[model samples]
Target chain A: MPPRIAQIRLVSSHPQVYAPCDDSFALVDALLADRTKLLDHHPSICMEIGSGSGYVITSLALILGSESKNAHYFATDLNPHATEVTRQTLEAHGVHAELLTTNIASGLEKRLSGMVDLMVINPPYVPTPEDEVGSSGLSSAWAGGENGRSVIDKILPVADNLLSEKGWLYMLFLADNDPLQICLQMRDKGFGAKIIVQRSTEEETLHVIKFWRDPDIQIEGNEAVSGGKTAPQRGFDFLRSQISRLSFRETRQ
Target chain B: MRLLTHNMLASNIKGVTNGFPLRIEPEKIIEKPVDFNPDFLKNMFSKIDWKALADASKIMGYAELPDEVPEQTVVESDEFLRKFHHALLEVHLEEGALVCPETGRRFPVNKGIPNMLLHEDEV
Candidate 1:
C-alpha cells in the first residue's frame, strides 16, 4: 500500500480556506518524524486544531496507519468553509475526522477534557494589527494579533486541560513567537517541552515543539515555579545547540 | 456529525453550567458505514458518558445501545459490539440542531459539520 496521506490533488479547497504551505508542511514533517513513537504510544483520541485544507491531520492519520484503528480523529476550525474543505479532504483520503466549526474546543471541552491522547496545532502565528485578528474572511487564518501570540496563548491552557495523563501535543511556532519563553511557560505548568523539528525558510523560520506532562515537575500548584527558570533555560540553550546542529546536517545533505 | 461527536459536545454558551449532551433535533438522520473496530469500542466504553450517548442515540433514531454500558462480558460479545459500533460511529446526524438542555440554545449541524460557534451575545 502506498503511504496513507491525502494527495494535494485530492485536497479540496475554498477561497476562504488556508491552503497547505511551508508551515503546514513543517508540521506534517514533525509528525512523520515521530511516527514510530506515536505508533508505540497508541493514542486513543487524536485531535487537530485549525485544520486548514486538512493536510496536516490527513498526514497524521496516514502516519498513524491502521495499527491505530482504535484511534478516533477530530479537528476544529473557526471558519465554516475550512471545516467543509477539511471534510472533503479527509474523505478524499478515505479517512474521516469529526470536524467541528467552532472557536477552538469551546463546545467540546468539558466532555473531552483529560481524554485527548494526541493533539496537533498549526495556529495563526502571524503578527498583525489587532483589528485583523478575527476578521471574517481568510485573514483570520494567519492574523495573530500582537507578536502572533493572541491565538497561541489562548490555545495553550486549553491544551493543558484537554490532554490526558499521557497526552502529547505538537505545535508550530515562528521564531518571533519567543519559543523559549513559551517552553518556560509550559514548564511552569508541569509539562516537559521539546523542539522536535525546526526548519528555516526564506520567508520565516518554523519550529514544531512537542509537549507532554512531566511527572517530575507535577508539584503542588502555585508553588512549583519559585526558581524554575534555570532548568528550562538550560533546556532552551541545549535546544539552540540542537537547532544549529540540525541545520548543519540539513545543509550537508 | 456522528453520535460520537454528539456525546462529547455541549452548549458551551458562557453562563450555561450544564449544557451537556445537547438535545438532538434531527432534521435528517443518515447512517454512514464505518469500519467497526471492537478494540476501539472497548477502549472508549469506560471513557464515554453512557447516559449521554444512550439518550443521544435514541434521539438520532438508533436505540440499539443499552441505557447503560453492559457488563464486560456483554460488551465483548459480537451482538453488543455491533450495536455499540452502529450507535457510536455509523449513525450520523446529517442535518440537525443540538440544543443546549439548560438554555435551549441550538447549535446547528449542516452538511455533517456542526456549527458550535457562539454568537457574541451568547459568548
Candidate 2:
C-alpha cells in the first residue's frame, strides 16, 4: 500500500530548501490527526503557502488520497529552488500541486480570493531581528522578524482574504510569536482558533493552530460584550482564564 | 500548467484587476496519461471555473471539454470523466507564456514551470 503521508525516502531535498523537520512532521501529524474530518470536509481547493520542500502539502494530498478527486492542490514559495524541490517531491509521490515561486500567493490572491477550501502553512516563525526577514534564499525560510510576527501578521490578513466561507487554515506557530495573541487577532476577523497539537522541543514550544470561521463568533462580534468589554478584550480575559485553568489542571495532576 | 492551477492564477501586476483566464500561448502542450480517478474529478468539478477551462482548452487546440459543464449525473460516466481528467490534469504546457489578461505581461513557462515573479518596480 502507498504511504498515507510522504515517505521520507522519497521526499526531495535541497541545501537551500528547508527540509522535513520536527515542525514539518508535526504539521503533517496534525493533518493526520484530523484526517477523518479533512476527508469528510471534502475540500475542493487546497493550498500550501511557503511549501519549502513540499512535504506538508504532499502529505496533505496523500492523506486525502483519491477520495477527494475534485480537490485541486497549489503551493507557493519565495525561493525558486524550494519550488523546484517541491515539484520533484510531489512528482515522486504520484501527487501533484501547481507550484509557484512567488511571495506568499501574491499573483494568486485576486483569482483565488474566497476560493481556497483548505490552506496550510509552516511559516518562518522564529523570532529574529526585523531586518533578517524576507532576506534572499534559505534565510528567508526561517526569518520571522521581530517576535516572528512580521510574516505571520502579513499572512493572517491574506489568509482571511483568500479563504472561502467554509475554508479552514492550519498553521504552525512558536511560543515567542505570542500565538494566543494571534488567535485574538484572528478572532477579531471572525475566526475561531484552537491548538490542534502542541509540542515542546529542547529549544522551543510549537503549536499547530487551526482556524475556522465561526458563525456564532462572527454574529457575536458585533454584539458580544463581556462585562462591558468587546470580543477582543474578552479574548484576553479568556486567555487569562485559560492559562489559569491549565495551571490548575497541572497542579492537580 | 494544469487547468486546475490556471483556474486559481491571476495576473497580480501591481494594478491589474480582473486577471482571469490568462491566455495560454503554448509552444508545447504535452498530454500525459494519469490514472483515472472519478472521485477526484467530481469533487474538483465544483471548484473549477468551467467557462475558463473550456475557453483555455480551446485556445490550446484541444476542445475536449463541453461548452457547458454537464450535470452531476455525468460524474459516473467514465468517458466524461476521462475528458475532464485529461484537460484538468493530463495536458501539460512544457513551454509557454501566460499572458496577463489585464497588463499584457507575459510570464514565461520553462521546463513545465511558470515563473510568476515580478520585477522590483512592478512590486
For every prediction, compared with the true complex, DockQ reads 0.89, 0.53
lDDT (Cα, tens digit) per residue for candidate 2, span A1-253 = 6448999999999889998999999899899999989989988889999999989999999999878776778898988889999999999999988888788988788778898899999999989999989875898999999998899999999999999999999999887787777887788788877778877676677889889887656443376545576554565576646544544544455
Clashing pairs in 1: none
Residue-by-residue lDDT tens digits, candidate 1, B9-118: 88889899888878989999998898889888888888889988888888888777788668889988999989889988999999988889998878889999999988
Candidate 1 has what TM-score? 0.92
User: Cα miss at B103, model 2 (Å)?
Assistant: 2.8
lDDT of 1 by residue, A25-87 (tens): 888888888888999999999999999889989889888978888899999999999999999
What TM-score does chain A reach in every model?
0.89, 0.89
Among the numbered candidates, top DockQ falls to 1
lDDT of 1 at A78: 93
RMSD of each: 3.4, 3.9
Q: How displaced is residue A252 in candidate 2, in Å?
A: 18
Q: Model 1 off-target regions past 4 Å?
A: A218-237, A240-253
- After superposition, the stretches of candidate 2 with alpha carbons farther than 4 Å from their true spots are A1-3, A219-221, A225-253, B35-47, B66-81
